[model samples]
Target: MPQATKLSAPTAAPTPALPVRGQTDHLRLIAEMTREFTASHDYQTIAHSALERITRYIGAEAASLFLLTDNGETLACSACYGPVDITGLRISAKTGVVGRAVQTREGSMVRDVSEDADFGASVDAKTGFTTRSLLVAPLNIGQDCLGAIEIINRVDGDGLFEADDLVLLETLARAAALAINNYRLTEQIVQQERERHELELAAEIQRDLLPQPSSREFPIHGINIPARSVSGDFFDIMTLPDGRIWFNVGDVSGKGMNAALLMAKTSSLFRCLAKSAEHPGQLLNAINSELCETNSRGMFVTMVGGLFDPATGRLTLTNAGHEPPLHFDLRTERFTPIPADGPPLGIMPGIAGSDGYAVTEIDLAGGMLYVFTDGLTEATTFGGGMLGIDGARALIRDHAEESPDIRLKSISGAVKLPGQSLRDDLTLLVVEDMMTARAASMPPPRLEAMSTDGEILRLRVPARPDRLKLIRAAVEQAAKYCEATEAWTFDLTMAVDEACQNIIRHAYGNRPDAGDIVVDFIRRGDCMEVHLMDFAEPVDPSKVKSRDLSEVRPGGLGVHLIKSVCDEAQFVPPPPGIGNLFKLTKRLPSKLQ
Candidate 1:
């Protein structure tokens, strides 16, 4: 291998100084080139124009700008200016004078190509252009060398390159290197911005595809939280025309756009086919066959789909390599896990066998069924440990007494720490057997004396803060009907309002879907008895106590407010189908009695 002679500034041959007019022209040309580089972001156009001006200024026959490829193993001619066009020519970084300049990060001037053992004659032979002398300057920005600029065969002054030419080329190479680097950086930034926008749009579309939150009394409910702008996990709930509810939870194999796309497809397929498909197993088979046709990346989806008949408290489920759904029995407080029975979708058509994925029939029997992606079990808990299956069961057991919507939120929120990202896409779906819960529980007993009093007013509303106003109106009207004074009516209304607030905050955990509240007002001669009822868990009379007035606080005031205005304020025997019954009796004025 032949090595070219490197030229250092201190040892370069000296040349005669240019005249004043010539010096002015050179300065003007360099200024113009710098302005062009700064104004335009196109690398090739600017490089070619600069090469033409450089070749003419140096009185060279041909000039070519070489840039290192991505791998840095070879130099390719990015632009050229001369009679012969060698724009796409490539050569090894160690084989020619131009390569030597870049590798050494210095300039090189060869007076005669034949005398230099480092000269590669293959380019001259291929293009039929004879090269005698050449000047090469490396394109450098600080200590980094990009490539080199090679000027071949000087057309003036005995056809030999001078030292002045090498100096000028090096100065020009710096400007060109800066321009190329800037263009690359700008291009990269634009590409990233575009990708970010697309991801956000995809995320919005995914959200629109999901079902809205159902009412608290509905038997099926679900929640989804993505780790990134998009998620690979998805869940869908669709109610068929025949009253059968179709629900599913799925996990795509990877993350980002590819996984998000697959999630969308699978969710769409379930929604479309589950409406008409008779069984969960056969519906999954159809989706699997459709996905196999276009899944070129070898990706797959693990899903569990089920059809629930609310009338029978029966669920027919089909699992395809997904996490086993946990069935929590409200009566026994036991968990039963139903594991997958087939491979994941998109692996191959009919991989679930001729009958499709195996179906598992479950009798919810007043219990709750939970379907979730691995994101839940793999999440990091506040205790700095992975929430494995045991942790997941604990979350479920803790919140099992709450409404379906609040239960799902509490379970998912337990692992979602503040100021931290999720490990994966989290999705959870719940199916409750409303029939069993209704049949097993009994209605509250009513007080005989108040029940007989003609039923002055009755109102039932959801247990929400917004519904408290309506209850207050009913209380005022009932107090007015009994001919109670303005002061008495105001006190009764305020007392009832505080009672409802306590039910929303304590019994329902402030959850929007926390069942309903029933109020009954009766006129008992000179006294008005108002009964407030809720269907939440039974409250212990010992635990329900008014706080002492000595210590002032924001809360614990509702109970005190209720007791202060009423003659009797206590939990009474509720009517049929009620959980907690609160009774308040206020005496009428002396004239009415």
Candidate 2:
């Protein structure tokens, strides 16, 4: 019967299905996607191309590609292709089926998503799309999971996503993962470059804002160093038209752009109001009020400002919640701390109250004044210790004899000597009550005559405040020899005393050891001329003018007396190696019949 069942045409053998066609297509899809991923370095472009390809190939209604946030706690949707744009959407990396894929570095298939325990329907609810099925695959390269690629609501009315789809999608996910990482790294480099450029520009602006050593006699110097490219610490030195100097040192609360901007505004205010305000306290009050009006960031500034008169050795100081200043006494070789006068600026409006900020006056004769921010005291060392206030005081006391510039450099070098980079800004301001670097470096003065006019009575004496009476007596005797009237004798004596006092106080910086002054009285036809020479610092020519007569002030009267009493008063170039030569001349009366 088996033989008879018949070969019956042997039933045409079924043709075996070709495996090459399907395999070739899958490989072609991978190759094409790889080319697209490498075409451009832009994150958005790569992400968009990947999402579009996956959504169309998988027959899905929507697909979203997410990358882990910088914090790695959440996933931010980078690209989307679907009924709704979810490019900026964010979701927790631990919340749903997507979380499972990223956590396990595997594939997830959810059919009838409503029935799945881990299926979060929030996205579906948000987009108003009814999701029937979803497939999520981890975008992983080695052990690092970049995030997940999710396809939702398949276009086909299939029962569920197949196992084959998961394997195919994971392969595509690997290529996309690398592209995402490259884009992210490139973006990070670009961001760093942009910040670097901004910092350089800010540094340049800050440099221009700082003061340079313009004065030939003023002994004030300051320096600012930033932890980053921009500094929050700032110091200002301005010479007023009335021969007084205004100086300040300040530290903003933080560092970088915000603090830098605040510092610029604060310093500008100090410069603008310095002329109109008479006292340091008044200037600070105006600055505080102005800063409070626009300081929405709640930042504060700790600062100290002073008005110094080189002519009188008087310094009026006003401190605003800053580190106490150190007054280094040249005679005692010690530092006395000057405490703060009020709270910091920008903390509250009307901080000065009804009377205004408190003012403190101190005589800086035979000493140096130092004001600095907290950075100098709070500089950290590798041993976890800080350069405290006591250490800073000792440093200043040790370098008391050096020039202000040299002393500041020494302090800064010691602060950063640990070789570690600074974590804060450093600022130092120094005003010495001694001859300036220029004067100290100059040789002794010698008498040199320009021309022979008449017989001269010359006298050389120590340039000291105590010897001023002797100078007046000598000048009076000379006036009598010239047959000057009694009234003229009194005016000439007073003028001589004022001139010597100016030399002793301003040019010599109130130093007792400053060189001697030479006074020569010459009687020419119809005129009497006196010449004064000293080996001291030259006075600033721009600061030689008289103050407004209407405005009342304690100092500036010396300049007024010299100009008012003499018919001609001027500064002349000193003999070679000398510091300064001042000339004063008065018209003599005609001989009576």
Could you give the C-alpha RMSD of every candidate to the true structure, in order shown?
13.7, 16.8
Assess every candidate by TM-score: 0.69, 0.63
Estimate, for each residue in 1-593, the C-alpha lDDT of model 1 and write its tens digit: 01122111212222322323266777887888878877886767888888888887777777899989867789999999776778989999877898899889998999899999899999877776778899999989888878899998776568788888888888778777777777778889988999999999999999998899999878899999999989999998888887889999999999999999999999998988887788999899999999999986889999999999887778999999999999986533579999889999999999988778888999886577999999999999999999999999999888865777888999999999977889999999999887424543424423223343546777778899888888887787777677678888999999999988888888777888978887778677678877777888777768878888898777788888999999999885432235777888888777734
Write down the TM-score for model 1: 0.69
Per-prediction tally of clashes: 5, 0
Candidate 1 stretches with Cα past 4 Å from truth are 1-34, 128-132, 155-157, 436-593
Superposition error at 337 for model 1 (Å): 1.2
Clashing pairs in 1: 443-576, 443-577, 444-574, 444-575, 445-574
Worst 10-residue lDDT window for candidate 2 reads 7-16
**Stretches of model 2 off by over 4 angstroms after superposition:** 1-41, 56-62, 67-76, 82-105, 110-134, 141-146, 152-162, 213-216, 296-298, 332-334, 380-390, 434-593
Best by TM-score: 1
The models' CA-based lDDT, in order, is: 0.83, 0.78
Poorest 10 consecutive residues of model 1 by lDDT? Answer: 1-10
